[model samples]
Target: GAGVSQTPSNKVTEKGKYVELRCDPISGHTALYWYRQSLGQGPEFLIYFQGTGAADDSGLPNDRFFAVRPEGSVSTLKIQRTERGDSAVYLCASSKDPSGANVLTFGAGSRLTVL
Candidate 1:
């Protein structure tokens, strides 16, 4: 794909249920990032993967949230024990610059609704 792609554009899950959001970054992009956006708020960085390793995951709010970029192109964000507070839009982005300074191309995001 020419741009970043995310799956399950909208998801509604009951509280305490689990959810997974998928992201397919643009071809050849090595830097992938996951962010969360609450209503009326800017995206908050959740994690960043440089290639297949997690370069940073400081923004993950708790142990219930985890993400992986195994092949360096696709990534998945897993949420366990989902809570109402977890309802938000999950955004995925990819940057092509090796220096990691290039502008990021972001996916439309997966909106999660926890009831």
Candidate 2:
């Protein structure tokens, strides 16, 4: 079975731009989550999707951040009006379900560097 995976691993973007980060979750997993980790800080939950619906998105900072899991598997995180404060490692994780203790298997993450 494949584990969660993310693209770019590193991204350099300027302020006020838009970017899309991709995530590929493990097969057969129905729960996906997105988190952002700043330097020396714990990962902050962004959004979580169960099946095709976003079960939790309150963690999203603002309208500038959005995510979707249209097919109930792969997910993508979109950021708009990027700012230097937004620089962080955006991580994606997947699990069997909440019943599975919500244990998340994480991706290496897409590191965003806003300049």
Candidate 3:
């Protein structure tokens, strides 16, 4: 796809379960990002990967949340010990340029519901 793509548009899990969300970015994009949005809040940045390396991960809430982009194109976000509060829409975005306000193309997002 020319834009970012996220799998499992909806997910339902019980508390304490583990889950994984996937994202595939546009071809040739060097910068990728993950964000999470709760019901009433705006998306909050979770991580940013440049190529296959995570350039920024300060936004991750805890060690239980992790993301990886081993090939620079496909990324996987892993969450352990899910909680009801973790329910949200996980958004993925990509940009060709990593600097200077370059526009990012965002995926429709994967909705997670923890019960």
Candidate 4:
């Protein structure tokens, strides 16, 4: 992909169902991030992965939310026990370096609707 790419541009699920969102970053980006954005609000950081290891995951709301980047180029965000409160757009971003957070290339995001 030329830039960050996210799958399932839109997703609708029952309140208790699970969902997975995938992100394929630029070919050589080393820093990947997962974020959740509510309507009218800025994206909230969920996790940050530097290479194949998670460098910061403190922003994850609970155990139900998890993200991984096994090979450092692609990532997936998994959510279990979905709730209405979890309905939001999941944004993926990638940067060449952790210090380059200010210049991340973000994907269009996957919109999750929990009903």
Worst lDDT run of 10 residues, candidate 4, spans: 95-104
Clashing pairs in 3: none
lDDT of 2 at 95: 95
- Every model's Cα RMSD, please? 0.7, 1.1, 1.0, 1.0
Candidate 1: misplaced stretches above 4 Å? none
TM-score of each: 0.98, 0.96, 0.96, 0.96
Lowest summed lDDT over 10 consecutive residues: which window, candidate 1? 94-103
For residues 50-114, could you state the per-residue lDDT of candidate 1 as single tens digits? 99999999999999999998888899999999999999999999999866796999999999999
lDDT, candidate 3, 1-115, per-residue tens:
7778999899999999999999999998889999999988999999999989999999999999999999889999999999998999999999999661568899999999999
Candidates in order have lDDT scores of 0.95, 0.93, 0.94, 0.94
Clash number by candidate, in order: 0, 0, 0, 0
Off by over 4 Å in 4: none
- For residues 1-115, write the lDDT of model 4, one tens digit per residue: 7989999999999998989999999888999999999999999999999999999999999999999899988999999999999999999999997664558899999999999
Q: Give, for candidate 3, the lowest lDDT window spanning 10 residues.
A: 96-105
Ranking by lDDT: 1, 3, 4, 2
